[model samples]
Target: MALSTHVPDLAALELLLGVAQEGSLNSAARAAGVSQQAVSARIRAMEAQTGVTLVHRSPRGSRLTAEGVMIAEWAARLLEAAAEVDAGIAALRADRRARLRVSASLTIAEQLLPGWLASFRAAGRVGDAAPEIVLTAINTATVITHVTEGTADIGFTEGPQRPAGLHGRVVGHDRLAVVVAPDHPWAGRRPRNPWPVREGTILQGARAA
Candidate 1:
């Protein structure tokens, strides 16, 4: 539902509550970082807008009348609810930031990522709010696609070269070797490294382990 036109704005309500709490316009103005004139003007405006006398201002100081006290009490409740709404929105934003979306190849996701995530959680490098990891285990091609298409925040692949439109770094290394049976002649005979290929599994993210 739309807000009622009769209600004062938050700033005016806040000032009203401040006046009630401080028991003086000058003190409320000082607390609100405004001049006393401005505070008086705002209170007058609030009274005009609500058609209610909200303050009893004297030469010595200012005081809330009976109606003013009731209005101030209602304003206090409204301000508290506003504060709760603000805090809830802030927490939602924090939760969104504290999530890490990851796309990794099957090998890295299955063989290596679990240990890395465990260590990352235990290290407390990101302070108390450790990021929740949303991991997607897929083939190397799809991993690159996820990063390129912006479906994933980070990606890992077993490709030698970096994918286009994305920065890459080698987080971990592995070697590929030919496997043979014990009865096979190549198993017993020591041969020079047939294929000396440096396999780099790149993990693309804000930071890598």
Candidate 2:
């Protein structure tokens, strides 16, 4: 079945995640125990729905466009929460109050979560916790808002600052990259020096200036 990109509709998100991790549609299909055709179809469907060219395909393999990379990062978090839910449930089976509140970025919310929840549900092992798992998805800005407001118990985001009035744990790390097209004259040297010297740019994201 073809996947949709407008919102990834669960199955499509899974496919995007597989492709991101595997780096090749064929490998993703193999790992997923599906056919290459299926993977291709999924990608096509997503691209159509989202109206974005998400993948750059070449002989080497496939790489994500900016949006694709963003989506993949988000999906990883959703995947993590799903894992926690499963572990919590497994622990609960042995112990019933195993609930947690997870706050994530919009990208993670849309691309790769339902499957994790679905898998946990399929396990059929109930958690001992209260069984109320709340999920909230917001941007880097709103995550801080949720944290500051004490509305969220946990947060996942790319923001480097530790906002006041909340405790944060580094559940994941992501690095921004500088990309220069292959046709550019600096492609060779660019690899050697990923970060170019700054001229007038000021760094505002870091804490304490």
Candidate 3:
């Protein structure tokens, strides 16, 4: 028989993650602000859709099956990505009374921007509430283009090179280090010389010789 194509809803996914963390249906339901019966029904419905026995229920409590653990992990990742998408959409809304427009690379958007924005709000730079911030995540080249064209008030990018026609300041720096297992041959080697080359060249060399 062909597998069902039904995808679990975000709420159900969240419930599964809660169950995994809380380790019991009653506790998961309480944390979710729902009744235990509701949690049970939702889990049953999810199992029916996926055609998998996800949870093992007994008089003691409820526990996830082996498949349930794997599915729950994936569900957690999906929910996290969904949250980022929601935040990006809120930032991109044109109707907001925005005080700042920022264009950033994916690394900055995913890793740094949220915390910085939270700090800015906490500092009360604008007021008790956060100033409206419109943000876009794009490539480094696109970030430069946006800043140069005045489409964004500020831009964040990686790499040392800066495009002309824009005043740049280094807010932070990151260094790439080669990581190897302790047992690997290169783990004990100390480089006598270091040289800079295009990233593509390094990747090609890794693949070739």
Candidate 4:
């Protein structure tokens, strides 16, 4: 896929996010361990690429424009996702003498894997050298497939039904609730005859909505 010319590079995006946090280019540069001039150059380059004046420079300091603030917010999210990808790659490349490869559903990988890994590390089960943890996030079917094929040591998924050839155990459960807009018909209705909500129905309704 072709990237837009307006999109700033990852390094420039990071600098923009830092400026948003520090509220000044010089301060942001200092915090990031980069020269002030380098920060300014990056910011200027980003502005040129984006075709927008991102910063308002003054004698006192620098401040982001309204658009700049919005862009910075988006940049922060992008940087966070990038960091996750970096960590996954590092884990794959780490010393593999003793490693635990895990395949997980997207929800579990995003919301639970970090905490679980941290707790496992704290328990010191792997002796002096910490066991390398490599994780990949995919759909539930793919998670099951990876485990069944012996490519992954373990798998985590959110689906209630387990596939064949796998011994399943429920570590936990998540409670789901129906949500609707205040004006929607279902907003205040407590159905006398409750029906099981299937994934296909919900997906169809969502597409229609």
Candidate 4 lands at a TM-score of 0.46
Candidate 2: worst 10 consecutive residues by lDDT?
A: 200-209
What Cα-based lDDT does every candidate model obtain?
0.84, 0.66, 0.78, 0.79
True-structure lDDT of candidate 3: 0.78
User: Which pairs clash inside model 1?
Assistant: none
Per lDDT, what order, best first?
1, 4, 3, 2
TM-score for each prediction?
Answer: 0.55, 0.38, 0.45, 0.46
Q: Largest lDDT belongs to which candidate?
A: 1
**Measured by TM-score, how close is model 2 to the native structure?**
0.38
Q: Report the lDDT tens digits of candidate 4 across residue range 1-209.
A: 99988899898899899999998998899999999999999999988899999999889888999989999999999999999999987776554436877888887788777898898887766667568789898888788777777777778877557666676667665655678999998889886765553121000011110
lDDT of 1 by residue, 1-44 (tens): 89878899998899999999998899999999999999999999
The residue ranges of model 2 lying beyond 4 angstroms of the native Cα positions read: 1-5, 58-61, 90-209
lDDT of 2 at 119: 66
- For residues 73-158, what per-residue lDDT tens digits would candidate 2 score against the true structure? 88788877877998988886544235545566675556544655566556654543234568887776776666555566555565
Give the local distance difference test score of model 4.
Answer: 0.79
Write down the RMSD of all candidates, one decimal each.
6.2, 28.4, 21.8, 21.3
- The segments of candidate 1 whose C-alpha lies over 4 angstroms from its true place after superposition are 103-125, 128-130, 138-209
* Stretches of candidate 3 exceeding 4 Å from the true structure: 1-4, 94-96, 99-209
Q: In model 1, how large is the Cα lDDT of residue 122?
A: 83
Q: What overall lDDT, based on C-alpha atoms, would model 1 receive against the true structure?
A: 0.84
**Residue 36 local lDDT, model 4:** 91
Which scores greater on TM-score, model 1 or model 3? 1
